[model samples]
Target: MSAPHFYLHNLGVPLLLAVVLFCAFDLTQLDVLISNQFYDPLTHTFVLEHDRLFEKLTHKLPRILPDTTGELAVIGMLLSFAWTLLPKGRFSAWLERVRVAPALRWLTAHRRDFIFLVVSFAITTGMVHYFKSHTSVWCPVETTLYGGIHEKREWFENFSLLHEAGEGRCWPGGHASSGFTLLALYFVARRYRWRHARALFIAVMTLGMIYGSTRVPQGWHFVSHTFWSGIIVWLSMLGTALAFYGRERLSQPALDAPRHAPETAAPGLSEGLSVSGR
Candidate 1:
């Protein structure tokens, strides 16, 4: 397959999944109906109100720069073009060998990576769900700045702009978790080649940071939320990598032993004895 197609196959599903998550949060009007108490220090009055996502998008902008869909598409296009331009060499051959048509072999090569992705998604999702039901301290990132001093409110006001938003109620910084999980997977899987491994590791780390920062502008999470979420993700990935690597080492030796030597029939013994006598 062509490079662009290859990348699309690998990355499209993940991107789509993220989009679905963001859309779900935006569409359910959670941002619109959530109530918060705002204190006006000058008037010494507290106002309780519900906030909307549309309002947040229009007014309370994030501190980080916005990314348009068009811009992202263009970037993907350029990256794909660059990948296709690279010359094929020994490294390419090795990569192909590892990626050959045999599904079992490929799975064996990428099992840890696949497991990491699965586990990361499950754990993050579960945490997000569990926290959504029990949190009352106010998303710590926004306790003072967005919600004021009120403690009786069940919901926090959504800041529509990046400038006004605070932290998340549930598991904050979902992006950080997603990005760091992938990073750890790459780090573990790339042990065969140091240079390529380092490059991939750097790329994933950068992506995780970028993803974390977007929470601020998106008005969904705070900086601290992102940081803590990232820590959790990093720890999870590291633990998973160690476990997977250990299991692989213990189970691999039996498979590596040769089953049998090249066979020579009894007739071959007669041919060996007549070599010089004739």
Candidate 2:
């Protein structure tokens, strides 16, 4: 497909869907309506507001796993770069035959992938946090509807300059962004033509939505907050991919290239690594 068509199919459609969903929630009362289901007016609390099991599994684990994955990717990227600086000799040759050789080869071949992942993670998380701090939107728990002093405000009202930004910091859900950030993995897998690319894409989307939903039951965010988080993270990652790979490279067919594709380096740098394909 042409680059325009590839982008439309891959990025445009998803973006449109996200905007439509955002509008549905923002323009309507769906955010309050959905939260009402999990909320108890009598107790003025969300059903799962303080459930330890739910909090640990859905909130804590989801946040930690993505962070841990990003750290591992950073380490792998560093190791791959370090491997290139090692002098070629008996020691390096012997190391090539060891099991670590295949991993190093894979890392070297996909160095850009790791960079994209880390950059996307930072961009998404930063955007979410920035929006959260600036916006006046309150979490369900903080609004009078859930037994707080602050009166509930509509989505657009929160953006008004006259509106006082409180301590709520719940606008574009942070926990949800953590989940949607995994969308980077799907993009990377697709770029490299990983055999399970389709499955990975579906899994990431499902996981993101599930993570976002968990916050709703805890009264930590409205549904629209999660929707906006997905939109932000998706666009951030898409932009990162375009900047790193360029349209021409992204539009090209995926190749089952050798795991140790020769990178432009010292004359014999690539020769020190195995040329095997996984």
Candidate 3:
């Protein structure tokens, strides 16, 4: 289907789901099941950092992927675009002439998608950070249940806008956005109808899911925090995709470049979707 219709179809339900999540109070239950302060036999006090395994493996590991890996993705995309900016370079010219790898060819065929990916990731990340900074919601670790510093509070209980003291500044998952934002890839893939798009989508989402999960055990965030993050990224990517590629193209081939991007086979990603979202 055309990109505008594709995006129009996809945004409705996700936006609804995000609204539901924002209004619901469904996190304490999962926090009980997932995170807990530890009992210290010697000190007779609960130790917040008792879980050695989660601390060692899961706690900060996500930082590397989202920070280092994310930077590299942006840089790579920039380099791809940079090749075109100079108008000519020996390596660039040679690379352009050769068949290059599918990965490279995919980038070449869908420059808009790459731009969408980079831009969407940055936009979503900035948005996530904005909420994280502006809202007073505490991280799971900061809540009393998770051996944190603050008492329980609603998701948006004391938003900065209300001029109340923020209970804390940790709502929605940040690092998760690193991979979750790649939801743009799913939309980009469908635009091109690339056979491997499904796999790529899954891989990107799994990375985010894995990264988000690690934070739970460390009390860095709540289950709902990550869920909200997924929702946020989906919406962010969708809005960006619509901007880049919402218009219907004429008779261009599926591989022809257009703008915009977003993802998942969960529901909205149907058979009519082609790569370019156009």
Candidate 4:
């Protein structure tokens, strides 16, 4: 496929949708819809909070899953590399014989994947924090709309009118990145065009959604913010995958075709040489 295919189809469409979705969301009351439908006015409670089931689901349960999942990912990579690097030993030899050996074998063949996962996880996740640091968009709990202190501000009201970064850093959700970074796993799995790619994508996204939900009850992120976080990470992962793997797949096959052995005239046509004699 051409370069444009990678940009326009794989990565561009998602980003365009993300921007459009975010902009269109501004026109809707879904934020308030979720707030009002689920939020209790008299008790100032979220209906889901009636039993703290949502609370535990969002606030506590993620502490066990995606939160540690990233660390485990990092540890696993480090262990794979470190153990592979160690001089032959009982433990290292044993590692090569275990269930993990297949993964380690895959890792050995996929050095680029190792770097992509370790690096892109940070890159994709960092964009969320970058927006958080620069954006004035407040969380649901930070605005007076939810019985908080600050007046609600449109996302861009401060442009040109003022210059300081607002205290609010909750625009694109941060916790969600922990889950979405696992999307890198999808890209890695997709490199082999494995059926597991779809499964990995689903698993990682579910992981992010669970983590993203945790902050909602506490008013740290609007549902849309969590949604946006997923979009950003999804787009980022796709783009990075394109960058890392695009040229290799596009060019390697053509280059792999053995060049025709130097073309030569038939023996009879070779500079008047006949087939029978030189």
Candidate 5:
């Protein structure tokens, strides 16, 4: 597909969908209404607020999984860099004979992919957390509807202007961003034309929603907060993809090359022998 076509289908369409959903949530009481379902008026708290099992399985595990993946990507990038620096001698020969050589070569070949994943993941989650810290939007648990001190405010409300003593640190859902940031994997997979790219995309979206929904029952965030997190993470990943891969590369189809293709030269090599020469 052409780059413009890809951008329109992938980035543009999803962005429009995000805008529509944002408007619906902002104009209506959907956030409160959905959160209300999980709220227990009798106990004056979200029913699953203190459910340890639910919290562990849903919230803790989901957040940890993506974090672990990001860490692995960083390790991969480091190893790829190291591989490029190895001298062409007995040591290099022994290293290549090691069982892990194939994996290292794969990483070296796709070092840019690992870099994109790591960078995008950091930027996406970082932006969400930054917004959370700055935005004065309260979590569902902090609002009066769910038995808290503050009056319920629409997401668009100017909480900063109110000069409230306790500025809320829960506008966009941080946990949701953790999961949504995995969408970077989908773009990476698509870039390489992985056979399971569609499946990966669906799985990432499902996982993101699952991670986001877990917070709703715990009153950590509203549905809108989760949706907004997805939107933000999605856009961040898209932006990073564009920055890393560029339109021309993104538009091209993956080459039908061997999985064990020979490793390209690392950065700073002769222009004729560089990784980009691939």
Candidate 6:
């Protein structure tokens, strides 16, 4: 296969795995319900008592509106369509400009930057993953609060936003990472005058917050989880940028040399010839 074809083929598997993993994570609680196991907690464990903020809301509307499910279904369809179609248009253009070529070029020119970025990303992801795996508690709330409706129905979880709905629901929020990543990437990609990049970041961040927070009421997660999600994403992005692009000065040779200089003056040396003085 050609280079581009091979690149796409390699990317396709990861993208598909990501989507499947997301779906499995989001729908996990719901799957328990469908298996008639949502009530297992009530049968096997002592109920922990507390005056949660959602007590009143849950009592008022124990079951979600059917239309909510319909709306989500519609939205999902629309997003799938856009994911397939919109990329060829505006999204493609943006990616072309900020493509890995520039990132790699920066790395090739500045080894320090490359080391920093890699280390930063590693540390941030490690922290996030550690917290996600060990710290936050996962108490499928609906199983205890409204187990009747959810029991025997996987689709019921789809009605309540409080129920986790995607893969990595138990992990440091991928939605938050997505939001922060977009913002950081936009800032990196568009450092010039005011642009739609800021607006896009804001919109996505809002969506991430809303999406993350929605999982709380259904007994999906605690408010702390959502908050940490945002914090982790923002910190990870900042860390990555600082590590990769922290160096302020450019390579003096690249900046000082004339643009139209011969290929021999571009830094690389051949045999006895020196790039800077050739």
What would the TM-scores of all predictions be? 0.41, 0.83, 0.67, 0.72, 0.86, 0.36
TM-score of 4: 0.72
Candidate 6 at 150: error in angstroms?
Answer: 18
RMSD after CA superposition, every candidate: 18.6, 5.1, 7.6, 12.1, 3.9, 18.0
C-alpha local distance difference test of each model? 0.42, 0.74, 0.61, 0.64, 0.75, 0.40
Task: Find the candidate with the highest lDDT and give its number.
Answer: 5
Clash count per candidate? 10, 0, 11, 1, 0, 6
Ten-residue stretch with the least lDDT total in model 1: 260-269
For candidate 3, the lDDT comes to 0.61
Which one is best on TM-score? 5
lDDT of 6 by residue, 1-278 (tens): 44455334434544564456446644455434432332235454213224355544432232232224334434433332332333365665674587833333333333332233334435555656655544333344434344422222222233333343433225455333433333443333222222454565577567557655544544454444444565565556554553444323111112232232123222421222221112
Estimate the overall C-alpha local distance difference test score of candidate 4: 0.64
10 residues in a row with least lDDT, candidate 2: 264-273
After best superposition, candidate 3 residue 186: deviation in angstroms?
2.0
Per residue, candidate 5 scores C-alpha lDDT tens digits across 1-278 of 87679879878987898889877898888888888888889889898899999998998777778989999999987786766676668887787777666666666777777778889988997777666655577887887777788886664564343344247778787787888888888877666555576778788888888888888889988888878888888888888887876666456565455232333323312222234324
Indicate the residue-level lDDT of 180 in model 5. Answer: 81
Clash pairs of candidate 5? none
Question: Which scores better on TM-score, 3 or 4?
Answer: 4
Q: Give the higher-lDDT candidate: 5 or 6.
A: 5
Question: What's model 6's TM-score?
Answer: 0.36
Global Cα lDDT for candidate 6: 0.40
TM-score of 3: 0.67
